[model samples]
Target: MKTIQVPTREQVNEEAQALFDQLQKRLGKVPNLYATIGYSAHALQAFLQFETSLNQGAFTGKEREAVALVVSQVNGCNYCLAAQTMAAVKRGLTQEETLLIRSGRASDQKMNTIVQLAKSIAENKGKSAQNLLAQFFEAGYSEAALIELTGLVTVRIFTNYVYALTAIPVDFPAAQPLPYALQEQPQS
Candidate 1:
């Protein structure tokens, strides 16, 4: 079987190499997933820009990480699961809280609403997300926030599919498997 190898900094074009330098400086290393995207200079820059812009938008870092955790879980992207698990912790979510979010709920009502909406959107591909959309607004998210949330989900889906396609090595520490209970938890 053919394998998609993660590109090395030296293997990419000048444009991607420059981005790799910036990523190395900023993050101490280019994550394998990002490195793989570096194989496409345009995609690497575009993804970095999109992520930067979204990070500056409506959600707090914690909230964004929460939504990412749920989407990563729903999509079964081990790369994102590992990366977002660490990011979620840095954003102040406890490991326990991360697990709960992965299961599509949270102890905090507002965050619960957010993750539930994320789960529904991911699972149903937006068609069956109406109830959760209503709940999202009722939970005090603005229409603007909804747009940002969808953007977040869309980017996550992109990366998830990248992992599915490439099977790139996860650069971050492997995320723990969800507890059996959470693994079987039914989505609301």
Candidate 2:
């Protein structure tokens, strides 16, 4: 049987190798999920470009990380949760803030709207976000910002599904369990 394995930079095509080198220089390591994507050079390049473009959109780094955290948590993707939790901290979110965002709220009203919208979209598969969308705009987000936030959510879902499909080793520190997961059960 063929076991799934994340490819090394050397195992991929020239294009993917270059992208791996870039990731190494920028992040100090090529994350396992990205390495698995390197199996298809075109996919790795496209995913990287999509992510980089979204980074230039209306959301600040902290806001983007917040969206990532909430969406990943909603999708129950441990890999993305772990990675985004670390990114959230780097973006200046404290551990408490990350936990709160994962639970679909934030202390800042504007961010609460963002997290609630992201969570609603993920939980409803984007089919039921109307109310949250209205709240998002009322919270002072522009149409352009909405587009950017949606793009952020889409990218996070892509990574989350990738982790689901591949079950690649999470290279970052594990995220703490969500509050609901930690609740003790009654004695059977």
Candidate 3:
């Protein structure tokens, strides 16, 4: 097996070095996955720009984090599951609520709608069911908000796919295993 090393702060280019400094200042450490992205400074910068743009969108931090958790879970990306689980907690979701969101359910009705839609998008490769779209709008999401939600799902999917491909060693604490019932099984 070819092992792709995670670049150290010193190993990265000047652009990635600046990003590492900023991330270290803000987050107290450069996450290993971000460091891996630093292997390509352009990609690292692009990822940061895309992520920052999504943060400025209509979805609240909690809602975005919920979507991230659901998408990560559906995609079986352990790195994102760990990172987003921590993010969900920081955004005021209880551990149980985060777990529920990862399972494609939520106690809050609006959040449940968002979670279902996010899961649908991730599972179906952005082709959500029409009824789910109806529920998303009926749950008081505007068309613009729907678009923003899709953007959030898109960004999360990018991370999920990258982490899945790289099998990057997770820097965040591991998330608890999903309940057996919530685990994705092979289709017949």
Candidate 4:
């Protein structure tokens, strides 16, 4: 297995350094994904900052994670599948729900809308079909929620695409890959 290329702390630029420090303090270590993004520290810092605020903002913690998991599932991002599965567990997501969502099979009434909307957003790249948008509204979500949903997906797309192109390693545990993802074959 190829190891993740983590820029040495000293090697990361000033912007990346601050983000790394904060992430270390918050998560105890910079995750492999974060390290990979360190190659473009400014971009990584901006993304992380946006991620932090988004996760802490409008959506409930579980909802934020749910959107992330569902988006990763839609994008067939195996690394995020593992990473988000762990995050979902930490957020107290039920094992059954997490498994279901990770597999693109969330069926609970509460999550149905967000899960579906997230998939549509990912599938359609944010111009969700009109009917799908209606479902989002019918689920009691305002246009603002949909907007937030879109923003969440925007964040994931950047990271997921980066991971795909870079074949970034997963320093975290091997998570169950999304049920039907293309084979997860991360390289150096």
**Candidate 2 global lDDT:** 0.88
Query: Model 2 segments beyond 4 Å from truth?
Result: 181-188
Q: For this target, which candidate reaches the highest TM-score against the unseen true structure?
A: 1
Which regions of candidate 3 deviate over 4 angstroms? Answer: 181-188
Candidate order (lDDT):
1, 3, 2, 4
TM for candidate 1 is 0.95
Give candidate 4's TM-score.
0.86
Name the regions of candidate 4 deviating beyond 4 angstroms: 1-4, 178-188
| Tens digit of per-residue lDDT, candidate 3, span 40-134 | 88988898898898899878899999999999888889999999999889999999898888889999998999999999988998798999999
> Backbone collision count in every prediction?
0, 0, 0, 0
What is the lDDT, from 0 to 100, of the residue 152 in candidate 3?
88
TM-score of each: 0.95, 0.92, 0.93, 0.86
In terms of lDDT, model 3 sits at 0.89
- Give the per-residue lDDT of model 2 (tens digit) for 7-63: 987799999999999999999999999999889989888889999999998888999
The per-residue C-alpha lDDT of model 3 at residue 59 equals: 85
- Per-residue lDDT tens digits for candidate 1, residues 22-57, read 999999999999999899999989998998999999
Please state the error at residue 127 of candidate 1 in Å. Answer: 2.6
CA lDDT, every model vs. true structure: 0.90, 0.88, 0.89, 0.77
Q: Local error of candidate 4 at 120, Å?
A: 1.1
Ranking by TM-score: 1, 3, 2, 4
